[model samples]
Target: MESRQRALVLHRLPYRETSLLLDLFTEQQGRIRLVALGARRRRSTLQGCLQVFTPLQIQWRGTGGTLQTLRQAEALSLSLPLTGRALYSALYINELLCRLLVPDVSYEALFGQYLQTLCQLAASDGQYEPILRCFEFALLQALGYGVDFQRCAATGTLVQDQVHYRYQAEYGFVTAAVASQDSFSGQQLRALAAGQLSDAATLRAAKIFSRLAFKPYLGARPLKSRELFY
Candidate 1:
């Protein structure tokens, strides 16, 4: 059966002499790869619609395998005008989705969240941190690696506002005696739990927490987008 959905091009590369291979995140089909025949040719209309961060209505059909042939693609709206940090951050989000999300599965909510993240990034200047952090946390939760910030993993005790804690992957947060570079304050945890990153400290903590949380799944290979940040 043919599947049609709204998608965003996550990554694309030249295929053969004239085609393009695309990794796409679709609202109905999670992440999938497609071959856009003749997309690289000068007159191919797919060239314009098949771009990173462009919202597209795409159509495809295939049997049981990772690769499919893209039948059609059309831009749903003007591509979000991202530049500098926002552009890099958008790339980071695309890379994360391509890396961590399972192919051929449905991540309906996460797909919407991803689009919203891009919109938020495009609308702001340098305030991409909180937006990225929120999307990262959401992505983690959607991938079944969500860590609870409201309680201690060690004792299941409620996280206190005055204490500190450290994230232990797969295991949730554990209480820390004092704050350190590796530890997060209870207030930060609470703010994160509430999805309220109101201060610099909480934003900083969220970044560290997300990096630590993603380390295991992302393996040792550093994300290429991370390099763009520095």
Candidate 2:
């Protein structure tokens, strides 16, 4: 007998002759892959429910070592259809999760953030840059690489309105003078710290800053979805 689990379908691919391999982000078990037997056949029950970016309630049966088989599934909701840039951005988010997150690492907070981001993208008429940046920050924090933007990395003093600062990858932020050659701006840092997303200039700056921050984790492979937007 297999255990039942609630999961978010993160990614899926065709498997075998008529099956599907699903990469799922679950509530209790974190990420796992399951084989959906004969899911491609017409009228197959599992075919319609399993899709990227959708929430799913699923049950699978397998022991400790082998790939599990999906026994039952149901769609939780109708995911908002994202098109054009929004679609690309959604794919970018998925790519980030595929690359950075480790399977079976329980991160309920990060999962919540992911769901929130999708909802934001689905509804907002605003630019997606700010939404993506905010999610990036949240994801990093959940993964234990959160940056400290409240105080100067050099002086350890609380951030002040009149002072400029620079962000470094290894060190969070330092006084402008001490930041040496790092790339960042005091205004942008403050804006992010304050959680203001409506400012376009601040949003652009945050995007650049986050790109630099996430570089190490992304390795040499460029995110293909990014190209669709750029």
TM-score, per-candidate, Cα-based: 0.97, 0.88
What RMSD does each model have against the real structure?
1.1, 2.4
Runs off by more than 4 Å, candidate 1: none
Tens digit of lDDT per residue, candidate 2, span 26-61?
A: 776667778999999898987777888677788988
lDDT values for all models: 0.91, 0.79
> Pairing residues by index, what is the TM-score of model 2?
0.88
Model number with the top TM-score = 1
Segments of candidate 2 deviating more than 4 angstroms:
63-66, 160-164, 176-182
lDDT value for model 2: 0.79
Residue 20, candidate 1: alpha-carbon lDDT: 96
Number of colliding residue pairs in model 2: 1
